[model samples]
Target: MTKLQAEVRSNSVAKGKDAMVTEDELDNLAYLKAVVKETLRLHMPAPLLVPHLSMADCDIEGYTIPSGTRTIINAWALARDPSYWENAEEFMPERFMDGGSAAAIDYKGSDFLLLPFGTGRRICPGITFAISTIEIMLANLVYLFNWELPVELAEKGIDMTESFGVTVHRAEKLLLVPIVPQD
Candidate 1:
């Protein structure tokens, strides 16, 4: 967490004091982008993408798919597959950074192994907007404030148990104390 804070702060300093963090600055936030990518990989906004119908007969890894079959793509499983990710279950953003094992992967749908957004012609139209919004919001949060676990949670650590739904969320709501960083 401290490392992530450092990354955001380091980039934020270049904007000078009192300048609003904007989308234009996102390009400089490589680590933040990697963190967002890793988060999407681990906890996809929609774990089960909308069902895609097979337009024609197709063979995938020897399995014959008859035309018109509704196929559900499990994005969560794809991200956890050891074949595609190193330390797949761990929350490590470095994997998406340059020179990391899965550096080339992206949520843009071209990469089958990390499709946070569904692929091909049916890919989500809001993908670019969503990614940009998240990155900017996250960058601002890290740049403007220092966050810490609530005192009650400091000793016990975070409970990451997730509750399944249309989308997944932590079973226990996260509690944080955000203090504006003093210069």
Candidate 2:
């Protein structure tokens, strides 16, 4: 979050402005978009996406899939697959930025590698709503405040363990303090 804070701060200064980030400004924040993409890649809200039922018998990868078969797309594994991603397990947001192999792909389901919001005819209807909400909220959070890990957490580092369920969430509650920005 410190890195994201710095990015937003730098963007604010580079634009020669110090005010709440507007929707138009958010649209042009390339790095912010990359950050959000990396986040979705790492932590897909729905790991197995909506279960898809095969309407007719078909062959995929030499495997015969019968009609009415229930198929679950493991989006989480797809995003983190070593074949598709470099430093797969690391949280380097730049992988989705310029000069990166996966930079062109997005979560719109068209790119099979990253499908946070499923794709195709059955894609999530709230995609635009979800992405915009997240970007605006995050941009404001990182831009308007200085966040710091609690003293003990700062010393010990944060635990990234996740608890799997209908949707993934941190196993342990993240305890961080958000300080009002001095600037």
Candidate 3:
């Protein structure tokens, strides 16, 4: 979070603002976008996407699938696949920074390597709406205050264990203290 705040502050200063994140600024904030991307990659809201059915019998690797087979694509596994990502278990937003190899990949469903929103015709219809809203909300939250876990909690570290079912989320509530900047 400190890195993200510093990045935003530097951008704002470059644009002649002391420290502010406007909707316009959010549009071009490469680091912010990377953060969001990394978040999605690490913790996809829906780890298991809608099940897809095979139209016809097919051979995948050495396994043969009969026609009309129900297949559930594990998007979470794909995003964290070691073959496609470096330090896959770690949260490194820099992996998606502009000009980086993963920068060209997106959640729009086209990139199988990172399909948080699925892909093809069955892709989430609300992708644009959701992404825009997420960017705005996250930008505002990150820009408005500095946040940290309570000292005791910080020492223990955050519990990143996920409770996977309908959707994937932290196993425990994340308690944090938001320190608002004084005017």
Candidate 4:
């Protein structure tokens, strides 16, 4: 296990909770989970899901569809729809705080609002492992490092431009300085 995993486990154990995650604990870690969910939402590794051919004719919205029609769901637009989220352009993780909203909904069922790993039986097989790894890594990084913008960059403010290709990356790479903690 990673250091962050150990720390989270230790903290939970110290509080008399089980070492492994419980449903209630998952519920309580809403904010942390929201951050991960939002990141996945905004930066979906695959912007579009694999095309699916309809088995039969269907009507979606006001549009009528024919049988065997190839359909591709745009994960990117769904993540940033203003109808579902306030300040959809901003990276506010707290948008998911309400249990009734898309941010708070569980991923196990037919969750169409946010499908970073896709949905249904065709969803990525590594979803569980990926989520756990990211959570542990983020927890460890935040716990261990004090990140700061450099003097020059801080003066000018950080640039938020993105470069899109096979995968998205910052047009300018993150240059924050990490200050190691004194033990």
Ranking by TM-score: 1, 2, 3, 4
TM-score of 2: 0.91
For all candidates in order, the CA lDDT equals 0.86, 0.83, 0.83, 0.67
The residue-by-residue lDDT of candidate 3 on 80-177, one tens digit each, is 99988988989888888766768788777778989998988889999888887888787767777788899989888888899978688899998999
> Residue 162, candidate 4: how far off, in angstroms?
2.4
- 61-142: candidate 1 lDDT, tens digit per residue: 9999999999999989988998767888999999999999989987778888988888999898998899999999988888
Cα lDDT tens digits for candidate 2, 2-100: 777777766764443356766767756778888888888998888888889999999999999999999998999999999878999888888887887
Per-residue alpha-carbon lDDT of model 4 for 1-183, expressed as tens digits?
Answer: 133344444444343222244334443455667778777777777767667788898988989899989888887888788987777788766666684356545545366777777787788888878887777666555455666789889988779787876456678988888776553
Find the candidate with the highest TM-score and give its number: 1
Models 1 onward score TM values of 0.92, 0.91, 0.88, 0.73
Better of 2 and 4 by lDDT: 2
What lDDT does candidate 1 reach at residue 8? 74
> Which regions of candidate 4 are displaced past 4 Å?
1-28, 98-100
Per-residue lDDT, model 3, residue 11, is 67
Highest-lDDT candidate = 1
Query: Residue 89 in candidate 3 has what lDDT?
Result: 88
Provide backbone clash counts, one per model: 0, 0, 0, 0
